[model samples]
Target: MKIDTVKGGAYALTCTEACTVQAIRADAAFITILEADTAGQYSFVAPGEAVEVSDENAMVTQVLKPAALGVTGRSGIQSGGDVVLRNLMAEAAAFSGIVNANGGIHVPLAAGAETDTASVNRAYAMGMAQLVLMHQTRTYWLTSSCTATNGVTINHAAPGCYCEVLLGANGGTSLTLPTTGTVSGGDYSKILGYSIPFRHNGGAAGTWIKVSMLIGAGGEWTESLDAGMDGYRFRPVSGSAPSIARLVEVTLYYHEGYKSRVRELIGVGKPPGYVVRTTESSLNYDSNTNPCSAAYRLVITQSEISYTSELGAVVWLVMGGASGDTVVKLADIRGWDTYHTSVSPTLYLDVQAGEYGGRVHLESPTILNGIGNNTYVRYGLEPYQRSWITAEAEVPYKEPEQPSAS
Candidate 1:
């Protein structure tokens, strides 16, 4: 069954704590407000408060939707190994749709709750691998000249290894140049020695120096560590593979509190005659990226944050297509600007219609650094297979029909 088939009821459960309702459920084709009567005050269920529904096991799933209480989608790279539980959406929807035919939202009881990471690491390690590769590449400049050298034989080192230069007897040092060739010595061959390319590790003092002051030792016959003492920085070494640059940026689009402003500006209904790219051929409506007009599908789900006719908490936008609506789905979200005032959080969505050469605009309020800037925008690359989409909660919507009548 589709999500719309389920019945939903809105009732205020508590009067003291912002008069918010704790849960919502589907009772047959109708929705029932959980704990509405017991709380003694169920009139506070405002336009943007919490929403709860029923689950598959005939149990109640609290805050399963992004609009529910304590529900949050936290994104980050896993630091260590760990095991965690994530509710698979498609399966949950299918399972929940079977009996009730009404979908449910599962609220995470462990927001900010610490959990073990042993098993989670195994799976999340994929993301961490990218960071590790970046670090390693940056350290050696991604060149093949950073390997250790073998002291046994002239050619016994690895493909990218370096050879050392020995200090000769006549105050001269034996430098093993990167190339292999013969050297000729003339009369002043003592000063005009074979060219041996070498390098040093800028020692303990953190002073950056390739070669220490060349010392003149008349001529001594000795084969020891001092023979290669005077340090030199590592020379230019070639690698088997060529080097290349890797610079990647991943941007995530989320609600920046613009949803709250929509309520104050224009609450729901027909979305203020917003224009969507349609084609000249027919009028079915485009949701995915439409080559004909550059129109695309974007997912937008709504829920109530703290609410009342005058004030309320901000709403969140979910990734993916909106329920039963596709106009906003296909629009491209672009442009971003951060504002200073609580009323001016940077939010600007530039919906471009390339195929048709047109554009639409979207903006929202955002909060930053503990202040309510209340605006934000979506930017960069368009939709990828598994990306995210967040809708502003303030954008108004048609209030779902009440269960008692429908």
Candidate 2:
């Protein structure tokens, strides 16, 4: 079964929700919708609105697929975990293929609800695919790092698969692999560091960092949790394995349908065009760094506030990387309105993408009282595997609009 492991993966499911017909919760072949026999208001209910099932059972749909498959070749739904659900040209022609991938989109999607055989409202519903990923952990001891004569495959390649390998800290050594690949968004370092920091935080939601500014500590069980579908072969970055005991886990996320056709999603990488990154950031009442490229927008899934100081905060953006940058104040983050610590709120900048890369910064209060420590801003990194095969829900595609600077 395809299960979204990240937050925001949960939409609302109300207790008193209605369905024209029964939708089997186990099937991803179709969608669940709220119907109205009177007004013909077949409008799409947001994953936001709640819906109830049975007398209970988490009124939410675990996964979904378009109702109909297009006649396009090699363009159908598939799953990350299930090989039984696949579509071939024959299947698409016969309309007998299974739609069950972790994260993927159509080849040439049909327009409107009628032609859109999938009836997916894709433009409004999906994103970089909300990837179907696989994760595994194992302990190994390496006395030496071998370059040649021994090429070991740690995790087998899956469809639409890019590979990433990491070294463990308990062994306290870094190893290099010849088979590892880099993501188009950035590099392995950014991918691992961005989310892991805030995720492991011990705060309420492990998002916000309070009163403490302790960074770069020693004996810190640091594991370069760098794993992605960067390439087909999953191997070490180089032969630089540590000479100690280590426990390592390699996770793979891919679109089941695009396994053989794995290509770049944004610039030049794999499918599911989205990259999310975070840092142990703090604003002296005025500063934040967006770990994303110009082609992407920054959203904080989890966050932390100042423990000693309660003040106003603003989520601002700087077009291009300059000190005297244009300050676009997106929204004001009121701590009083939200929980003081581990504050997780939705903050985004309403702006257009230009040829230049922009930065999302958090500005702290210039008018607040004395505080012992700087305001810590820890962003929770949610699992984001999305694809933009259509304009569905306004997903960006190819080059991300390198428009003239506005």
Candidate 3:
């Protein structure tokens, strides 16, 4: 008798009469066997990856099919005594075919949440090993203490993965560099020195000397310095010689392809249409000195605006400009000498100008009376077209979704 199990659910089978079981079949390419016994009972989980099961006849067979995207199923089979079992399910040529077709290999951060030196090193090593096996390139961030003796080392010695070491702040201390030699079947070419400028909280400037080692093809280690880094001589005499300058941080980066993709996958890359905001001070502009005009006006000079918006247009809005009255004035006045008067407390300026770039300005004149000191002027970019309808509108911020480990 043949029994069918539901997909993505667990199952167990038991033989009632004295009969031999032929095989366990599944629609998925992989099945995980939990347990089996001679007492005519079998238990297993089916269909996310590939697994093998042995029957009383000692016949090895592929028991499941590759699962559909995001589908997980499990199943099992059993048999009784005095029965001749035959091959029930078709066999696959090789395991690699299934994995390749399904895109099953995904190397996430090793110890993604850990910060300690040992955990970081171990996670880096594991990630690098996985990358090496897949023949892909990636850059890993490994955090370590500035006082560590051995520092961090890459034992796998593959060219695809670059290891970047992030050293924490150390006060006037010297760090030991990795020595030159063969390690884990890989040769270390030599140690390269780098001189970088350092300063603490606007203090006097000092020089920080550091060293890094590289691994070439076939486990050969060599010294390589990235661009924009100044080379220096590394000489350590006797014990650890502490420097007068404090070390804020040290980063040893290895260059490799696919860095941007790796950064995007790890949620560190900047998303499209990114925007940043910086708040400027609030000030009160005195009434115009011209006695004949008697108009209380506020001027937002070009120097106050420092950031450029992605869109060339600049939208300005002023609130509570007139005393006691509450009126709103909105316009796309790009050039200077634009005047607006309102009896209400609100004033709005919509300037559609990228010609001035980050130097856009706003000037509002209160024709009714002198404006109050509580007035506010805000300048920002409206990504869409400039219109009076969206004067008070805003765009909401959304967080990026991370890839699922499943």
Tens digit per residue, CA lDDT, model 3, 1-406: 3334444443344433323332354553333344443435444343333334333333223335432233221223333233222322334344433333243444354455565755777777788556433321112112121122224232222222211122233222122222111122112211111111111111111212222211111111112122111221121222332221111111111122000000000001133221112111111222221110122222221212112222211223222322322111222211111121111111111111112211111121211111121111222122221222222222321232322211
Compare the candidates by lDDT and give the number of the best one: 3
Model 2 misplaced regions, further than 4 Å = 1-87, 90-100, 110-299, 303-406
> CA lDDT, every prediction?
0.21, 0.22, 0.23
- Candidate 1 is scored at a TM of 0.16
User: Scored by Cα lDDT, where does model 3 land?
Assistant: 0.23
TM-score, ranked from best to worst: 2, 1, 3
RMSD of each: 31.8, 28.3, 29.6
Candidate 3: segments with Cα more than 4 A from true spot: 1-99, 102-209, 214-406
* RMSD after Cα superposition, model 3: 29.6
lDDT by residue (tens digit), candidate 2, 237-349: 23232211111111111121111011211111233222111111221111232212211222111133322212233333223222232333222222221122111111111
Better of 1 and 3 by TM-score: 1
Error of 1 at 248 (Å): 24
Candidate no. 2 TM-score: 0.17
After TM-score superposition, what is the CA distance of residue 383 in candidate 2 from its true location, in Å? 8.8
